[model samples]
Structures are given as C-alpha cells and as structure tokens.
Target: MSEETRDEPQEQSLFEAPPMAEQERMVEAILFATAEPVTIRELTGRMPHGSEPREALEHLRRRYEGRGVQVTRIGEAWAIRTAPDLGFLMRQEVVETRKLSRAAIETLAIIAYHQPVTRAEIEEIRGVGVSRGTIDQLIEMDWIRFGRRRMTPGRPVTFVVTETFLDHFALETARDLPGLSELRAAGLLDSRPPPGEGEEDAEGEEATDEGQEDLFEE
Candidate 1:
C-alpha cells in the first residue's frame, strides 16, 4: 500500500470530530434554539461522536458570563437564559400582564404557603370550597402542580407550587417566600374576613392527618 493511502485515513481521523471551539458554538446553538434546558447527555447524543459537550458547555458558559444572556443550569440540565440583571429587559419586551381573579390569587397564595396540601386542606384553610376553575387556572398558568396522594382514606391527590412559580417570583426555594406579616404589609393578604365569613370552621379546626402535615417540613 502506498504511503499516501495510509496518510488518507490519518487525515480523515483529524476531521472526524469538530474542534472544541466549534463544539462550543454547536452547544451554544442547541441551547439557544431549545426552549427547555438540555442535559449534557442530551447534548452529547445530538453532537458528533467524540465531541466534548461538557467541556464545550463550560467554555460557552464562561463566554456568556457578564453578558446579557447566560448559560444556566437547572437541576441536571443546561439552558441559555437571560442574565439575572438583564431579565427586566426581556420582561419589558415580552411579558404580557394578566390580572388574576380574587379566587385564583387567594388559591395561589394558599398553595404557595402550604404546598403539598390536599384540596380538603385548602378548603379548610380558606373556610370555603375551592372551585375547580381556580385550581385549573393556576395549573394552566404553570404556577401549581399536582403532588403525590395522601396516605389517608380515599388517598386524595395533593397540590404544590411548581418550579416555574419559584422562577417567576425569583425564589430559590419555597422558604424564600415572604412571611404572613410581609404579605399583610404588602396588602396581598387582608386582616379582615373574606366575603362569607361565617360559612366554614376557623383555621386548624379540621384535624390534619399524621403524615400529610409534615410534607413541606424540609
């Protein structure tokens, strides 16, 4: 076999995988195009074999540092998101403000404060039956989600605030939520009774199930 023929295979190997810089660009493009965060394994699957997506992602992340857009990690996934400082710019451009109904707002606040709470618990807290539409509205807004069922009789499904809710409020965790005093000070909560005051039992009047009460203690 000729030397040139042997060298042909060597040359082909050099171009088999993209360079690190090109890989970084590829990662950036994928992250930019995706609406949801992409995991390293997902990126590797999408890239050519031997491409170092993890390293490339690190490079891309550093390149975006201090910029208007940044590569951020959510759980095990990565996504290109607006920089924290510049999020207001995008909010101003793209956010459409929508007013929530009083019922929906109250339900959302209750869920946020007492998450992994059962529908029955919510009714007990508000001293009124929670309408299906209110829960549906919050779910449609992606602010609340269904949690695991309680171990009690009938095993009713529970509800909790979603990560989207935390992100929208710029909260790292549920604990970051303001205290009752703060909510009252902000006028989000009122000291006076709601419209139908005498309808239901007072707060904590309904006994809490043993295991269900500690769901959010963590």
Candidate 2:
C-alpha cells in the first residue's frame, strides 16, 4: 500500500512548469518572433500553465544586458531591439515622401511633454493656433491619439503620445524624454522662437509644407 502511495504521481509536481532557465528561453523566443512590444499578460497567456512570465522576463532582461540585441520595455510591453549604438548601421536611404513641418514638430513636442493636454492648452503654450492638418498628420502617423476629455467647460478633448511613439523612440515612458540641452544638441528643438507665433493663419500655411524635415522618423 505504501509503495502504491509513493508511486502515485504528486499533484503539484505533475502540474509543475519548466525550470526558470527554460522559461527564459520560451520568453526569448516569443519576443524574438513578435515585431510588436508584448505585454506581460500576453506573454503569460502564451506560456504554459504555472509559468511565470514576469519572472522570466526579469531573467531574460538581465541575461541580455550588454548584448547586441537587448530586451527593452516600451511602456508596459517588452521587445527585443538592437542596441542604440548599432542603430546607425541599420539605416538605409529611402525616398522622402512627407515630413513634419515646424508647426507639426512643435505641436508634437508640446503634446509629448505635456500629455493629456487639450488643444487650447497646446495653443496657449505655443502661442499659436494649432492647425487641424498638423493634428491630423500626427494622428495618421500613429504617434499621438485623443486622450480623455477635460472636466472644464465644453469638455475639450486631450491628446497624448501613443505606445508607437514610445516604441519608435525606444522609450520606456514619456518621462524618459530628453532634457532641453539634449533636444538642442539633437537639433530637435530650436532656441529661436517659432517663425510665426501668435499668428493663427501662418501655421496653416506651414502645415501644408511637405518638404519640411521630419523630426520623428520610422
């Protein structure tokens, strides 16, 4: 009877998942196969029962430190991306179709830095009226999206940067945005005041400029 009892498979052991190292490999494989950043919930759903995806991700992230391709977090999701220093090697010339005008760039920057901001607030900060085309172009790029409406009168809609923006810039969160000096160094920001501040009509003209330089590139 004792022998039979011993021979009976333990319930816990039967349901036990693979070791952490193997789980790490599984997580690595999924992240490698997927192009979009994957959330922990998604990883857990795909992994076997009793698997711990969050723990596996921690192990995988630490293991990948200093590697050619490291695991990166974009907002709440994770992805394997080429190291920052090696990015230039991956760039290839492509036909320049459309680029962000100065108005669009400024508008995007405003939204990114002061997220969940209303159009009125954006105009207040920029000292110029934001053209509808500028907002449309940004939305079409999948960079910014409409956020919750304000509690104030008229319930103005707000704008905030998207996960795509975080993924494109390799940022974990909006707080990871560079400082003023860094923006200046990268030429993303200009010291001079925008060409047509306080003039509602001038921004409309700039919004139509397709030849302008693109600050955000895919």
Candidate 3:
C-alpha cells in the first residue's frame, strides 16, 4: 500500500501544475489594475514576501510575444500596452496621420520660439494643464530638452528646442520662426494671440533670452 501511494504521488507531480496558474493570475491582475508603469518593488509589496513574480512575468511575456499586446519595461517600470501594429483598432477614427492637439502645438511653438522657457510660461500661454506624457512625447520625439535654469524666485527648470527640432522644422535658428507674418503665410498660425498677458511679453527682447542664445547655438 505504501509503495502504491508513492507511485501515485510521483505521477501527480509529473502532470499537475496547480501553483503556476495562480501565479499567472496574480501577475495579470497587477498589470491590469496599474495605470502607471509598475515596478518589481511595487509588485513585491503586494505579493507574499520573497515570491518570484519577476520569473513569472517573464513566462507571461513570452506567451504574449508576437501577439496583439506586449509586456515591456521602460527604465525601471513595466507595463502591458497595445502592440504598435494593433493600436489602430482601439481608436474611433480611421487613424489618419496624428496631428498635435491645439495645446501641444501651442506649447511646441512657445518652446521653439521662447525656449529655455519655463513650464509656467508654457502653461501661461496655453491656459491649460500639462501632463508628464506631453513632455515625454516631445522628449521621445527628440524635439526638446531640459534647458538652463532661470534666475527667478523658484529657479525653475526651463525647456528648449533640441537640434532635432530645428533640423526637422528646417529652421536656421530660433530667430527664424515664421514671425507673426510668416506663420500666417504658412497657415500654421491664425491672427489670434496664443493666450495670456505673458503672450505679449514673450515676443519681446528679454534678458533671459540673451543667456539662452549661446546655450542653443546649432
């Protein structure tokens, strides 16, 4: 009877995988509930002490590889997002070329024109909130960079257009920006001012700009 029970145990161990299914479920739940990219520190916090979700995530990622969505890591963060090829299905439109939103375009223009300008200035011009992703998108596109500090009260970090931005836009320098007249000719800007009291202030000769000139020479 003892020998028979031993044989039965070995047979069950060979064929059964009960614990892995549970691990997979937990990992899937973590990724689903997390809107921001999640990291190992975060997952371990919610998991039983010393449990290996990293190994399990690798397994799940392999299963998802070459499929609709993918599991990817950005810096220290991990996220499951739509695969590039299938992103079109999630949208309502037919997905013509993506154009920047009015706020984004306005932000880009300010950064291009006034650059090394502060976020406060960008916000002041657009009259709206700005998200990190907005900055990230511009960074990912290599169109902007963190620029020299303003010698203001807060010593805020400012943004400046990258060489890539100038290259892409075919401008010799920041000074070449279409001017009110040229932007109108290119149909890139209408007569309406960008916004705010500072909008008028930005197009003027300021001491801050004098410092930025040597910094962004391209």
Candidate 4:
C-alpha cells in the first residue's frame, strides 16, 4: 500500500544489482572467447560462477534482437551474427559459389572436425565406405585436400582441410575448427557416426579410441 513498496517490481529480477553495461560486456566476452558455436548451456556455465547467465543472455538477445549485431541460434547452438543488411560486408570481391551433396557435407564436417584424418578414419566416422569419387568430389570443390604422410610404413598419406574450406565456412583457418573438447561440449557428436565402412577387417585393421583408423588398415 506504501509508495516505496509500489515502486518496486512484483517479481525480483534474476540478475542482482550488477550494472547493465557490465552484464552486456560479460556476454560479449563469452561470445568472443569461445571459438565454437556456444549454446545457452555453455553460456550459463561460464557465468559469475554463482550468478546465472540465462536470464542475462535472454535479456541480451532481446536487447540485440533487431540491432546491427544480433545473437542467433543454429540448431541448439548460438552465435552473434551481423545483421542481414551487412551481409554485403562479408562478400568477397571475387565471387564463386560451390554446391555439395549430403555425403560431401557429411564428409567435409568430419574432415573439419577431425583433421589430419585419413580416408579410413573418414570412412569409419561416416560408417560407410567413402567413395574414392567422394574424395575426388571434395578435391574438385577445393574444400578438402591431402596432407603429408603419417610417417608410418608405406608412408600412408593423411588428409587435412584446406584454406578454402575455412573460407567457405566463414572461419579464419583450420585452427578455428572446434576443438574436441568444444565439440563434445556442444553435444553435436551425439548423432551416430554413421554406419561402418565394413571392409574385410584384419586384427590390425579397426578403429582406435581416438577414432583414428588402425595402423594396418591400408
């Protein structure tokens, strides 16, 4: 019934009395520091250690909803993206676009996430034999390419992602690819690694814990 009581809101805000500017800055820091697509879960995990981050992030997203820079979701992941009006800024002076298949996209993601991977490693992750033609297709797209040999017997060649792949993915370089820890955190790998490539397996030919192919698979 008192004026002072009336002035206060009915429901207490989730965040304490922290300055709004500082809260926004913290959100910005989390966004910039993370190399991978961070989710609401990961964002909240990094908050004040005592304070929650969800309400702050939801608040932040609302604040930025229509601004030049906005927080957006892709699947369950989140990222700060430039406004569509600014899409022109990201365009290259020389333009070329490439099309890829579902198989190619799957292969490219495997290579990007697990670089220095070999054909056997890719096949295992895909759970199906990678057509020699699929590799050739990726090569034609200039998105993936061969790396140096693994320095093992027969000098087995390794495969790594190319700079073009990074460019297409809007990343700075291969180092910008999400780390194993980050990938695990995002839960993107929860999906099955496809089906086995199922070639005749010898004792020496199988998948290793690191998901690297066995030594004698060649």
lDDT values of the candidates?
0.71, 0.78, 0.62, 0.61
Give per-candidate clash totals. 0, 0, 0, 2
lDDT (Cα, tens digit) per residue for candidate 4, span 1-218: 99999999788656575565676678778876765557667866776544446566677779887788777554355567676566567656436444443455556667777788887887787686766766888888776788988877777677877755554344555545544333333332332343764222222243322442221112
Per residue, candidate 3 scores C-alpha lDDT tens digits across 110-141 of 78877778999877765555656667777787
Q: Between candidates 1 and 4, which one is better according to lDDT?
A: 1
Provide C-alpha RMSD values for all models, in order. 8.8, 7.5, 13.8, 15.3
Top model by lDDT, which number? 2
Ranking of candidates on TM-score, top first:
2, 1, 3, 4
By summed lDDT, the worst window of 10 consecutive residues in model 2 runs over 209-218
TM-scores for every predicted model: 0.60, 0.76, 0.41, 0.39
lDDT of each residue in 157-190, candidate 1, tens digit only: 9999876666554455676664444433334444
Query: Cα miss at 82, model 1 (Å)?
Result: 2.0
Assess the local accuracy of residue 76 in candidate 3 as a C-alpha lDDT between 0 and 100. 58
Off by over 4 Å in 3: 1-21, 93-218
TM-score of 3: 0.41
Candidate 1: list runs displaced more than 4 Å: 1-20, 50-55, 170-218
Top-down lDDT ranking: 2, 1, 3, 4
Model 3 lDDT on a 0 to 1 scale: 0.62
